[model samples]
Target: MSSSTSTSTSTSTDDETSSPARRRSPLRALFGRGSLDIQSTLLVMLLAVSFLAAIVIGSVGYVNGRDSLRAAAFDQVTSIRESRARDVERTLAGVQQAVVLDSRNDSALQASLDFNAGFAALDEQSIDPARQQAVTAYYEDTFVPRLDEATGSSTDPSLLEPTSPAQAYLQSLYTVPFDDDFDASLAFDAADDGSAWSQARSDHHDYFREMVDQLGYEDVLLLDLDGDVVYSAFSGVDLGTNVEDGPYSRTPLADVWATALESNTVDSSFTTDFEPYAPSLGVPTAWIASPVGSGADVSGVLAVQVPTETIDSVMTGDEGWADQGLGRTGEAYLAGPDETMRSTSRELIEHPDTFAADVVDHGTPTDVAQRQVATGSSVLLQPVATTAVEAALQGRTATTVNTDYLGHEVLAAYAPIDVEGLNWVVVAKVDTAEAFAPVDVFTRNLLLSTAAIIVVVSLLSLLLAQVFVRPVRRLQHAVNRVSGGEIGVEVPVKGHDEFSELGGAFNDMSRSLKVKQDLIDEQRRENDRLLRTLMPEAMAKRYKEGEETIAEDHTDVAVVYADVAGFDDFSRGMRSGERLALLDGLWRSFDEAAERLGVEKVRSSQQGYLASCGLTVPRIDNARRVVDFTLELEGILERFNATNSSRVALRAGIDTGQVTSGLVGRTSMVYDMWGDAVTLAHRVQDVSSQAGIYATERVVQKIGDGVPAVDSGTVTTQSGEQRVFRLERPAA
Candidate 1:
């Protein structure tokens, strides 16, 4: 470990004899023995010791910090997803209410029922001539044109006579133009004949058309009690066709019709899960079918087409997702009971072709991402296979880590939606790569920072060794003269480092062997002040009066850890100067509690404070004192909030066990303690949720006999059970 020169000195020190004064302040003790041998060896030892210790501390810190940051990230992501799912459910519920109100107020339904009753009263077969003409006109103009645009069909749909229900649906494939009012479109050439049949067809078509435009439906249909499409606003080709015998017999709409027929009350309605509606060029769609009735007699069903874009807007905010905090790859979407996505993806919405193309190029054809992209429907109708969706579809709420539809690892939250008549699930997720990106950056930056610190320390160690050793060479010359009985000679001490101080000490020793007897009284008083700094009063007195080493073995010592939370988010938001100012002020307040309680304050770091009681000064109430100190921290934090307008709180952990206590690190004089007890105290801090003072069973066993400790119960993990308690600060 030592450099070439340091190795040679070590060999020389092994050969030469060491003297007594050179043994006192170890560095001066080593050099005063006629050798650079020990000084060079000590230089290497100090560098190696500090550098290795720093590497160890840095590694442990980086690992713990990385884990904590990852935990915070997951919590943030879960919250974002839950909020989005609630929003989606709330928006859909409102829309469902709108449909129910509109269906109840649809005037065309009453008029159609009135006309049907009148026509049935006619013994001979009767049909509305004006209604027939309007149907033909609607086919020739709107239906034929929009169909041609949607499917690129040049054939005029009106030219084909409407002999079948399929043909009838094709003729009414387009909605009414926004310019035409429903009242005007439905107003037939009615005379004083008092027959409503004249505009029965016009009334049905015009009212449904107006509803689609006003309520933003893609299409609307009126199906009778027998599952027959009696009228259609956009895709009216299915009129007069029973769903079981119609061209769209196999679709989800037909299945929902059985439920729709039964929902005859004004408030009752049926909402179907998505399926390809053959009537609408075989595109994916969902419909809310409200009952069209006269009291208890169900006349028909008013099926309003839910535009996929409405749900898309709910998932992908109309403005953008800046407020959602889902990052680049996060998205919210709905999944039907059939497990297919029922809303458009943000990826597909942004770059429609890219997702499909990427999935194809990657060759994972069976993947959900590929399937959704390939569906080509306005609302995605692709099946997904994942734990979150599966659990959500089963009506369970879940937040988990899983491989997403795209085969990318994601942190996902899914919840079953309980809309009036739809079975759907909301899934909100983000690619783990984007979500935990800071962890990677943090690790790299930590390594770079540690490397820089090591390099600087290495360089400073070498530089200081040379600087300190320069004066020691002069002291070596002066020590030789003093040893040879040349008492007048002095070692010029010119610096503040170890060697200069050693040289000064030697100069003092050689000049004052005659005066050393006179200065003994002064040194004893200085020792008294130092003892007070190092330990409690009783121990300090023993140490000063002549205890060689101050140490104790305690059967029960209560170790406590108190930390301020949200510091990462806090420090990141503030300027460097401001951050240090805040921490300095906060710690100053934190230290006061330990100072007043006679609890030995050990050390403080970014992880926060460490303290212990009943070691230096023996006491039976170590746990009691530790809990009291923690409660003081709560008050300090409470005051900190009142003054700073901040909600930042302290989180603490307490444990009772045996530990060795002593003054360690000889040169610097550090009074420190350690054991399994210390580690558990820190571990408890991690397990706690907030600024809650938690104590372990060991602390409880000792404190419970006297103090009122509320058992907080145990945190059972796969690893083991950790029993803890919360101090309900025993009724004063």
Candidate 2:
């Protein structure tokens, strides 16, 4: 009994010794521990001084330095812009002065004016009968057809009053194959480029080239008031082009001429901002134009070119931007009315090897940069779309921290350049990183000085490590899967903390990216399908390749035209959605049949559906294919009638022959076919309300062996009688 009592008493004493009172409290465990604790406390004090003190000092320094740096950058670029603007003004003003002197003293412009006066005085009665007949024939054959093609429709000759100024002016603007103006311009240009046959023209050409070289110009051009480039120091390539009619009219140089001609005085001159001159292989070019004569005696324009290098130099300052006050990442550049950069960047010129990488980071077309870099070309084609540029272009001077064209965050200062006949913005910018380099340095120093506090941090980190490590590891694995394009993964969410929230975010992001990827794929497929439907795949490719005129010849294409016979009256009784739905269903059925039959359905509308065979890719049995498809179309109509209580009727015409096909409109493209085959088909469809189906003679000849048709005789119309056959059901 004594031994048992003694054991119990000993156990109670041991329990009291190991109680909560025996252990150190949380606070004393940290602040009251021995040697390691003293070192930790001292480190914590140093960290407070380093980090907290640094924050107090750096914030004030950052704010002040940022404002000053932005202001200085803005001031520097604005000054450069002003200097460049003055240089452009002076250069263009010189061209004007020279042209005025030529108008008052030279014979070339006077002779040109006399020629124009003589030409304008002649009317239909004053000209020779043969010549007048030739003009009328030319107008009827060439001008009328071109006008119809341009407007995408034909008009009655009676509706056009030839005597009207607008009509006469438009006619005069036409470039007759070898007109006198084109011929003269070609001759002068050939002489200048040393290709002239005539000795006198050759001497004149040499003089022009030498004069251009002597004046530090790229080219010297003389243009008649009618907008024909008469003489060129370069070559005959652009000499024959009339500014009012040819493709060159789309360029900014043409706009400069229009501006110059707005007034009839020698003092009237204009300059254009930097743009791609198409005739010169789309290089950045600027032009200045002035009239050849003063007052009513004005005849033509004398234009001079200033190399973009000269402008670049002014923007960057003398001696390669060293005096421009921009640090490693700061640059001053010019943006024209088109929002395209006009001046070469400083860093690009200096670091040609890294051009591609730098521009890629800025979100530029890296291929263009790589190509330019390979050839040691300047980076003058980048656009600047920041708020500073926007405000500056709109005639407001502003400074802000924003994103620049290269997609870099920058402190930007921008202002509009004060120059006549131009809308240009000047932007000065420095990278946010470089601009805050001092603050970054201060932050690094503070972190380095507080390094002794690592012992305490390590201890705390060890305690939390088990709590964070698992979720973070799972998140890292999930991220790797997502990066590898396996976006269906989900990180397991744990207890609610920042790490758990991070896992939730990761899952949400995975879902979002998957949805986005799906949408992008769908959009790409839709775009490709839409483009192919709007035009032939070949033509669509050409259009995407930047071809302005997309037309092709198909010698044996079969064309079809089909329309709802009584759609207008039928639709009058139906709601808009119902009417549209009917058309949609009808076209969808037609599309299905087309796919089944291998016929190309190019267009469809409320009015009709137009399709072709052998239009893009050649098919030897296209005629037969089209015939079979139309036969199936009739069966489809019968089936549709069986399904719907209200009856819908259709009329169709088919023909096979040579046709010319092309696209129209810049915004919404339309593919159209034209020729006797297409015309006859459309005409047959239009007149056949009760006939149901008509096939022209061409179709019967090319419909191969199995297709069925009956002789339908001739149908008369605007294009004269077209012999056709009626498409009839075969005897089963």
Candidate 3:
């Protein structure tokens, strides 16, 4: 009892001394008492991975949403721009057709003639000179003041005054009476001035005025072939003035008059770009002119002023911008080659103060904004020299984000309008802040959602770490056992979580491994069997051992080459399926016969069968065995002929000599023989004209009297002449 107590005390003292060393060890320091355990480590790693994934997903989603919203915004603006362009082109084309058709009609021609004749008669009739002076006073006092106010230009009224007495007399009646209401003057058709021109006006004036109202024209005028404005629908200051040499000769109307006169065809019409005109209170005007008569009978030119409000209506959706899918801060407008707007500005109509401040901020003079506001229009007033406008005027259609005329970043779509004579570009734009508002909201919500996901995942991962680690630890133990060479080790499966499925899979895998090991051994035996069938056993062994090249020279070997002599003609009458089936059966019989006769089949083709003796396995009577195999093939073919109505006979050759044999291909390897013996056997088999077994002298001498034969033929060789014999079965 004293000895046992002494031993226990010594062991206790030793353990106490080793405990400090154990605490200071590398492994202990790595996972010390204060360090994180496996569960904590797993929780931390899962949370880190989840946070990273959430960030990546949120970033990617934001980028994609921003891109999609940008693309959608561009598409909307581009669609609106293109639609507005088409509307502008369609409106201009309609105006051109109306002018061309009206100018060629009978009423226009008669009115042109009557107005011209009546004007000449008025000059001869001695009209009142005082009334003519009143026409000049009306232009100087009333017309020029309004023209200067509207156009912001100082113009002498004499420049727009009538140059003839007949012009003064006509304007004194039609125009001077309605100086207070000039627009109503076009409708004043019930005049009884007793002049033929006045009577012509009463007849055709209402028709022309209705055309102006129905077709949305500012005015319509008839000019004689001499460029004399003989009749006017509005009877403005341009009445009876020669467009060729009048004071307003520098205008686009004069240019159109010259073009119409120069072309002189009824179907030919001319158009002019928008320009400030002295008439109609100096409103921006474009003109369409067509010849008055058909072909060579052109008597006069007809001019129609293009309406600005009609184009603005189509482009702005009749000022209902929001209804056209353009939300607040969006507008569609046209810009001329001069960089001035052709359509009205939406901002000027909706928010004039904002328009003024924006334009001035973007480098437009303050006076220009004031002028636009005064006229209550943007045409020929607002300048758009943006990148989109420049590109469009250069005939490029594109959608992009750029600084707009007001210097605001905008999503703009621009394209050139396809009008015949106008160098105009259509632009549809929306402020970037407004267009990307949804994207901003999406980004904010995405960030909030990502934070929520991180919080939820953090809590869930802490719980899941415990759940996941238990199975992992169990699996690790089982895997260690397997690594230690204990296969078929299984872990206990618990709940139906992924861990449970994984444990079940591990157990199934352990069981499948044992079964697969046996299957592998069986498959190896099968592969070896197939390999031995393809080549000699020795060569197959070397091939499976990964031999790169395998060839052997055998000194005394017998090779037999046999074929169906009439197989071509015999198979010609059979279908492909029947022929193949017969060939497969015949080869099988030959193979079985070869095995019985101690011969090995090298390879067989549809044309022939080849075999060897004493190549793979040595035999003292290899020649006798090969000759017997050849006779057996003859019997096989004879049986086939009897059963299948085939007339095929066996032709074979046998040679006994040194030959080289080896596996011959890379992927689909084949065993074959090549040497003088193989060559001579092929030559002898082909030379026999009859169906018989031919043999070389070597084979004949080897077989001796085992097979009966006769001298057949001679085959030429490099050594000298080799004799061939026709061998027959020994009295079989």
lDDT of 1 at 655: 87
TM-scores of all candidate predictions against the true structure: 0.52, 0.40, 0.61
Better TM-score candidate (2, 3): 3
- Per-residue lDDT over 1-732 for candidate 1, one digit per residue giving the tens place of the 0 to 100 score: 000010000011221234444433444454455544655766787678877888888879888878887776777666766776777678667666766665666474674464445333431333355544555676567555655554445855544334353333223222232212333322322323443333455445456566666777776666666565655554334545567765567766687677766655767767776665544544667777777665676676777777677777778777376566877888878888766688876766667667776444444354545446545443544556578889997889867889776667888888887786778888888888887788888888888988888888878877777765667667777766655445556777665878677777777787785365235445545655555544556765554444557677777788987888766566687898898888878877777788798687766656577789877677788788888888888888889778877777778889888887665543345555677677777777656465578888878777666656666767553447878777665555
Query: Clashes in model 2: which pairs?
Result: 191-205, 192-205, 362-406
User: Which numbered prediction scores highest in lDDT against the true structure?
Assistant: 3
lDDT of each: 0.65, 0.63, 0.83
lDDT of 1 at 416: 81
Where model 1 places Cα greater than 4 Å from the true spot, the runs are: 1-61, 106-198, 201-207, 294-297, 361-381, 455-473, 480-488, 493-732
> Which candidate, 1 or 3, has the higher TM-score?
3
Off by over 4 Å in 2: 1-211, 366-381, 436-732
Best of the two (1, 2) by TM-score: 1
